[model samples]
Target: MELNLPESRSRSIRCIVKLGGAAITCKNELEKIHDENLEIVACQLRQAMMEGSVPSKVIGMDWSKRPGSSEISCDVDDLGDQDSSEFSKFVVVHGAGSFGHFQASRSGVHKGGLEKPIVKAGFVATRISVTNLNLEIVRALAREGIPTISMSPFSCGWSTSKRDVASADLSTVAKTIDSGFVPVLHGDAVLDNILGCTILSGDVIIRHLADHLKPEYVVFLTDVLGVYDRPPSEPDAVLLKEIAVGEDGSWKVVNPVLKHTNKKVETSVAAHDTTGGMETKISEAAMIAKLGIDVYIVKAATTHSQRALNGELRDNVPVDWLGTIIKYSK
Candidate 1:
C-alpha cells in the first residue's frame, strides 16, 4: 500500500518542533523492563516515519538532566553501537541533569525554588555548567551526522541584552529544515537582568525556535496530557480542551497542588529552576502565533504524537495533537 505523506503547500515549510523530555524519558516505575512509555513514544515516531506524515528530517530532542558538567560526555565513541537513526540528520540537545540540578540547587540559582539572592560564585558556576552541557550535546549530535552547533544564551546578542538565547540568526536551522535534516536545541542558563541569574528551560528554546521557523504546528510532547485547569492527579480537575493566547499573551498559573478558582484569568507561576513551564510555553505560543503560526501541546507517552501527525485534518488543525490552542485573530 502506498504511504500517505504529509500535505504541505511548499513541501518546504519548515516545522520547528519541540519534543519535551518527560514524554520520552524512561519512567522509574517500569525501569525493571524496557521502558514501555519511552518505547511507546519511539513507536509513535516510527509510525509517523512510516506514514510520511512528518518532515523527512525529524529532530528528536531528549532534554533530560545530564550527570554533571565534568561527567557530561557526548562522545560518539562512548555511544558505541547506538542506532544510527538516533542522531542521523538530527540536531540534538539535552540538559545536564546532574550538573544543572546540583549547581543550581547548591548555589540557590532557581526561579521557583529560590527566594534568596544567588551568590556570585554560585551564579558563575551554574552558567558555566549549562554552557558546557550544550557543548557536549553538540559534539554527540555532530558525531551522529547531525553536524550540531551549540548556541549560548549569553553572547548570542539579544535585543533585551538578557542572555537567554543570544537571538542569533537561525538560518542554520532553516538550512537543516530545507535539507531534510533535523536541528536540535535546548534551554540554557541565562543572565536575566531582572532576576540576576536564572535557568532557561528547553521549552523556552522551543518558543524562540517557533518565532523563527513559523512551522505549521509546534508540538510539545510533555509528561502530562495537556495542561489541566486543575490537577488531573486530583479528582475534581478538568482538562482545559483549548486556550487562546490573549492580546497581552500571559498564561494563567494554576498550581498542581492548589485548587483553581477563576478560569477567566490568565495565570503564570515561577518555573522550578528554569524559566520554562506551561506558562512559559503558552506565552511563547502566543508570541509565535503573532507571526501566524499554530501550536499544539500534547502528551508524548500516549499515541497522541502519531495520531496528531497522521490523523485526519480538521479546521486547518490535525486531530489527536491534544493540547490547548493559541489562535491568531484575523
Candidate 2:
C-alpha cells in the first residue's frame, strides 16, 4: 500500500494537472459545473491532497471564450456548494477554450497568425479575453478558501500566442511550490511579439509547469484513453503500454495531414487528442521528461480529475517512470 516513490521526492511536491474540457464538461462540452462527475473528480483530488500523496496545488483548464460569445455562456461560476465537503484544498485554472478556439480559427490569431501585421484594436481585444479568463479562475479558487495566483505569459511581457522563453515564469512556479500555495495556468492565445497571435493549449501549460517546477507527476486527463499505434476506432490498433518520449520528435508526426494522431490512449500508453493531434502532446512530454518528470495521458472516462489525483490511474510499472504510464504498464 506504500507508494515506492523516492525519498528525495517531497510528499508535498506540487502536481500540475491539465484537464481537457471534453472530459470534465458534460456531453458536447457543456459546462455542468455542478455535475456529479465533477464532484467525484474534486473529491478524488481532495483525498489525494489530504493523504499527502500530491501537493495541494490542483489546477483545472477553463477555456475563456470571447465576451458575449456563446461558448462563454455555457457556465462561468460555481466551484462547489459553499458548505460542500470539497469546497477547497486545490487551485483551478480554466482556459478560454470557448473563446480562444473561436478566435484562433476565425481571426487567424495564433503565434502563426500574429506573424503578419495586426491592428492594435485586435491585440487589445485578445489580451482582454485572456486576462479575464485568468481572473475568473483566481476569483473562484479564492472563494473556495484555496488562495491562488494567476501566472500568464502576457503578465510576463511575453506574447500569449507563441511558445517564447519562460524561464523566469517557470521559476515563479517553483516558488509557488516552495511557499505551499497553488499557481494556476492555462493554454492561452498569447500575443507573440514575433509570431503575432499564437495559440497555446492546456497541454502546453502543463508542459511549462512540469519543466519549471519539475513536479513528481503531470497528469493530462483528456477526452479519451492513452496512446495507440493507430487510431483506436480501428479494430487492429494496439495500445502502447509505455513509451520513453522520443527525443527525435518522431512521435510528433502520426499522419501526414494530422500533425498529431487522433486516438484515445489506454491506461498504459501515450494518449493523444486528434484535434491538436499527438505531435503536440508528444513534443511537450519530451520536454518535461527531460527534466525527469513523469507525464500520464488518461482518458477522462476512467480517470476524472479526482481519480488521477489519488494515483488510481498510475500504472504500477517500476520503470524510470517517465512519460504516459497507464494502469496496464505495471
Candidate 3:
C-alpha cells in the first residue's frame, strides 16, 4: 500500500520522541487514552516544529553567540524555510499502557514465545488491543496535521531467545521518515525465535532506533517532570536536573541522596504495566547516553512541561530545560 506523505526537504535535524503510556493514557484504566493530554502533546510538537527560532547546530551548548562556535552561526533562514515546509525528520514511539499490558500479562505473553496453544489467542488479543491504541494516537496526530503512519513492531520486528531485538525491517520506516511522513511505532507482541512471541518494550524500540537512525535527540515524555532524587511523592525529594556519564561510560547521580539508603526510589512499573516502567526507562537512557547522545526524560501532559520537547532550550543547558538530561560529561 502506498502512503501519501509531505514532500521532503533538505536533510534536517532528526529527533526521536517517545510518549509514555502513563502520560498519554489512564494506565490504571482499560485502554483509556488521556485525550486532552495527548492532544496537548501533539499540538506542542507541531508548534515546536513550526517555530523556526530553535537553534539546531549544537547538542549541549548555550544558545548564546559564542565566537567561532557553530551554535552562534546557525542559519536561522534555513530553519525558517524548513519549518515553513515540514518538520525535520522525526519519529514518534508510544507505550501500550493499559492497551496491551493488561492483556499480555494475563496471557503470559512476556515470558517469551507462544509455546502454549492458549497463548496463540492471547497474542491475537494483545495485538488487536495495541492496534486500537495506535489508531487513536494516529488520529490525534492527524488532527494536528501530522502525516503520521502507524508501524507495528509485531509485523516487522523479531526477537532472539533472550527476547532482545534480533532484527527488524526498518527500511519502510526510513523511507517514510525520509519521505516526510512521521512513522508512529508502538511496543507490541512480536515473534521470538526461541520463546515464540514476547513483548517488546517501547524503551527497547527507542534504543534500537537511536542506534540505527542516529538522531540528535531522544526525548522520553513521561508522567513525571524528570528523574528525581527519590520518588516525587516522598518528602524533600528533589529533581535531578542533569546526569553526566563518565569517561568510562558510567553515570552517577551528583546529589547526596545516593549516600542515604533510607530514601526509597520509585522505579516500579505502573499497576497495569507489564513492562518495567521507570526502571526500564532509566536503563535505556543510560545506554543511549553512553553513545554520547543526550536523552531527556520530561513530563508531557501539561503545556508548561512540554518546553524541553519543543526544541527551544539550549542543548547544553539542562538547568534551563524542564527535564532530567542524561548525557556524558565534556
Candidate 4:
C-alpha cells in the first residue's frame, strides 16, 4: 500500500530512540530481559516526551562562515525546527536484545528463504519472542502514563531487500506521533524480497525513520556510558565524549577521556546478535550525523541520558554533556 503521507525533510518528529538489545537484556542469556532497565527507560522516555521543542535545522561545522577556520555555527545541531512552534512528537524503536536472536539464528531466519520448515517455524518463533518483550515495554510505558502504541514492523508493512529496508508504510507511525501518541517499534523478523524473510534491526529502523521524519535529534540509549575506544567490558576501555563524522562517512573520536593518537573507534557484538551490535550503532549514527543531525549515544537510566532525551545537551558553549555526540563535520 502507498503510504501517501506528506513528505517533508523538515522535522515532524522530536526524537527517535533506539533501545539497544544488549542494554535492556542479558544478551548472553536466551530470551532474558533486564526488567529494571526497561522500567527506567520507560520512565525516562515519559519525561522526555513531556517536554520538547519543535524541529529546527541542525547547524554543523560551517567552514564557509568562518572561511579559514572551522566553527560550530549554532552547534546546537552542534545540536532543530523551522516552524518555531512548541511540541514534542516521538517515535521509539527498540532492539531484539536477548529475545529473538537465538531463535532467529537457530532457524536461519536471517537467510530469508522461508520455504524450509525450520526457517518458517523460526520466523514465527522469533516474532513471539521479540513481541513478548515489546509487550512488556509497552506496559511499562503505559504504567508511566505515556500513550504508547506498539507497531510491529511485519504488521506495519515493513519489508527489506538483501537485508536493507525496501519499503515501510509509516503513515500510521506518523499519524500516531502527530496525534501525540508514541509509536513503539522493535527489531523484527521481516519478509525480504531477495531472501524470503530476514531480521530487520532496530538500528536500521532508526535510520529509516530519521531519514523520513527528520527529527530535531536522535538518541541511542545503551548500557554503557557511550561509544567506547574498545569493548566496554575490557579493562582498557575508555568512553569517547564526542565523535565527528565527515561527509565520506568516516568517523574519528574528537574528545577521548584519555588522550591518545588513535581516533578509530571499536566495539564487539554479542554472539547471539544476528544484527551487528555496537558497530552498527556507530555506523548508522554517523549516517544520521551526515544529515546534519546531532546524535546522542548515552547510557540509559542515568542523569546524562535524562538530560539528553530532554533536549538539554546544548546549554553550554563548550558542550559539556555526558555522552557521545556524533556531529557532522561539514
Best by TM-score: 4
Clashing pairs in 4: 55-80, 55-81, 56-80, 56-81, 75-78, 75-79, 76-79, 112-196, 112-197
True lDDT of residue 94, candidate 1: 39
Q: Per-residue lDDT tens digits of candidate 2, residues 1-330?
A: 111222242334546666554445443332233244344544454455555444334433334566677765322354353232232223344444333444444455553554355533444555566566566545444443344578765554434423553323444554554455666676565555556556566666666555545566667765556566666677865555455545443333221234345543422222222126555565676677666666676664343444555555444643332224521111
Superposed by TM-score, candidate 4 places the C-alpha of residue 135 at a distance from the truth, in angstroms, of 1.1
lDDT tens per residue, model 3, 289-328 = 7777788788896553556666545444544556778886
- Highest lDDT, which number? 4
lDDT of 2: 0.49
Q: For model 1, how does the per-residue alpha-carbon lDDT over 147-177 read when each residue is reduced to its tens digit?
A: 3456554444321223355344455455654
Superposed model 1: Cα runs more than 4 Å off? 1-13, 24-43, 46-99, 108-160, 163-166, 191-197, 246-261, 264-272, 309-322
- Predictions in order: lDDT: 0.50, 0.49, 0.75, 0.81
Clashes of 3: 6
- What is the number of residue pairs that collide in model 4? 9
Error of 2 at 217 (Å): 1.1
RMSD of each: 9.8, 10.0, 11.2, 13.2
**How are the candidates ranked when ordered by TM-score, highest leading?**
4, 3, 2, 1
Instruction: Give the Å shift of residue 266 in candidate 2.
Output: 13
lDDT by residue for model 4 (1-330), tens: 234465542446779998888788887778888889887887787678768532333222222244575662434433243333333688888998889988999999998779999999999999999999898777667665566789999999999988888889877788777766788999999999899899999999998888878888899998788988878789988878888999899988777645676545676677787888788889999999998888999998888888988878754413556678998997
